[model samples]
Target: MAQNPERRAALVDAAIDVLAREGARGLTFRAVDTQAGVPTGTASNYFANREDLLDQAGRRVYTRLAPDPASVAHALETPPSRELVRHFMHDIVRRVTADRTGYLALLELRLEATRRPDLRRTLTARLQPEYEESIRFHLAAGLPGDRSTVSVLYFAMLGLIVEHLTVPEVIAADPIEALIDAIVDRVVPRE
Candidate 1:
């Protein structure tokens, strides 16, 4: 079907709002239409099914959350070191916290993906290249450790992001950037 990119993008953004606010069970075409303030059936017309809507929403969230190219390039210019990793980690925490709703929507997509094989496949495919890029960046930067270090750092940051976003009280004692720096210090290995 011919799709209006602007309308489709709006509906997908509306879907993100619905996912973040209502959770996966509440993410329906009607909810997205309502969130977008469009007439009923608008979302359904744009998205063939829930899976397609979710896939688009997930991609949108990634696009919104990914680091800026200029910032990444600047960081890449510096040699990879513990300080560099900490800087990037701090940037990530700031970005996620700044766009908490988007990240939460992504978390909702992750949960939805667990139950839906199609979504799981799509999300996994979407993330594979990012993971590869991180590995390449680490190697190129000459960071210590290996892919396993990258994996550990990824999951640990993810856990921190989840906790920091959901239950601020759980980590309220430590400053977020400090906590991120500490985590990066422990995981990235010394130069």
Candidate 2:
């Protein structure tokens, strides 16, 4: 029989809470069960395995990082010029500060991907959209429009994520601050 909806959500929420509360190593069925107020058996029934559980957590993470309608509206209404990209960076900084757990787990997943090839596949799927969207935004701004350029931006964002997750300094590089400045300086508008 399928688990109750409330019960199922409880479990998923619990998984996120557990990851956030206890770090990746502390997330387990037993812990999630207790946190969710479900039986251990119930957790097993729902998830069936650890990877399945982590995948769920990853999806939750993806949703949090995703741009919302309001954010999207802002992006469209205001061009993703250097200044607008600075606002996007502020949002990223706020998220990293507000939800330390998600940021840490995100980096942890990246680190784990080095050893687990399958995890790399999973993360890449979630990452591609962000990459495409960001690259397309810059492309619209008359930035470089090429496959390799997009790949560089994608990996550069990943690198920045890791750096901030580990260091999380009070003052950090402004996202797109330098990148945008360089773009403005180098690329004269060609009409």
Candidate 3:
């Protein structure tokens, strides 16, 4: 495998784009190289096989989608209230929607994971900590909800996002921000 970190990261990013555009079955070293604008076999040198490429793409998507540290810190500065929770949820939707390709790549990873047990385990392992941390943050920040609230909000936002991204016309009449506010209103208790 190549030792150049920047080049490797670029390949993984390109792989993510390929996965989003082509799905798992269409991901290939040649396709990745073409996407990355690198010479043929460049991706092969960085990744051992298709699985390795897919795994790296999955990891990269999370990295790309993670909330900005500055934004998180700023959110923390505000008193944790139902309104704050709404803001955070809105931020999540905004971030995901802004990075459409990354989210799409993540969706591809989820679909691919369904067919591969190893991938399912890998994705579960990767996401479990983040999920737990969200719960912890909600409690620690004095947000007006418990684990169950956060869990429901997570699923609800995920469904909303999937619909907004994949078939937006289905929900075209409803504003996404309003839907998010409604979800937070229902899930988190008022002060």
Candidate 4:
């Protein structure tokens, strides 16, 4: 295994781009190597196998997309209100739209997971924490609704994000901000 954490992270980042750009079939170590502009077999030295690479890519996607803690903390310090929730949803949309490739890659992983139980398990393990953390954040924010509400909001936002990112034509007719406001209105408890 590579002792250089930076090198390993770079390989993982490259793997994410390959997976997103080429899909699973094209996500070879060689592909990652090319993407990273490193010598051939550089990815192999860091990753044990395809599953390992996929796992790292999946994990990397989340880490890359995670919200800045400072921002989250600032928001948390503010009074918890439906308005705050709406602001949060807007931020979500902004972030997702900004990094369409990363989200698209994550969508690819979701499809790949269906065909491969091992990959599914790997992704589930890597992604389940997102849900847990979301719940924790909601609780800390004193946001209304039980876990189920958070779950609903999560899935709804995910659906909107998926559609917006993948098929702009499907929903481009309507303003996304309006749509997000609507979602937040329905999901978050009324102040």
Most accurate candidate by lDDT: 3
Q: Write the per-residue lDDT of candidate 2 for residues 22-80, one digit (tens) a residue.
A: 76678789999998886667788888687888887788776666656687566658644
Give a tens-digit lDDT track for model 1, residues 1-191. 78789998899888998899999899999999999899999888887798888889999999989999899898888877888888888888889988998999999998988999999999999888888888888777887769998888888998999999888899999987888888888888898
Local error of candidate 4 at residue 66 (angstroms)? 0.5
**TM-score-better candidate, 3 vs 4:** 3
Greater-TM-score candidate between 2 and 3: 3
lDDT value for model 1: 0.88
Enumerate residue pairs that collide in model 4: none
lDDT against the true structure, each candidate? 0.88, 0.66, 0.91, 0.86
TM-score of every prediction relative to native: 0.94, 0.71, 0.97, 0.93
Write the candidate numbers in order of decreasing TM-score.
Answer: 3, 1, 4, 2
Where is model 3 more than 4 Å wrong at Cα?
none
Instruction: For residue 112, give model 3's deviation from the true position in Å.
Output: 0.5
Please provide, for model 4 over 1-191, each residue's C-alpha lDDT reduced to its tens digit, 9 standing for 90 to 100.
43689988999888878877889888999999999999998888888899899888888888778788898888878788888888888888888777777888888888899988999998888779878888888877788777887899999999999889878789888989999999988888886
Clashing residue pairs found in predicted model 3: none
Clashes of each: 0, 0, 0, 0
Pairs clashing within candidate 2: none
Cα-based lDDT at residue 25, candidate 2: 76
* Residue 147 error, candidate 2, Å: 7.0
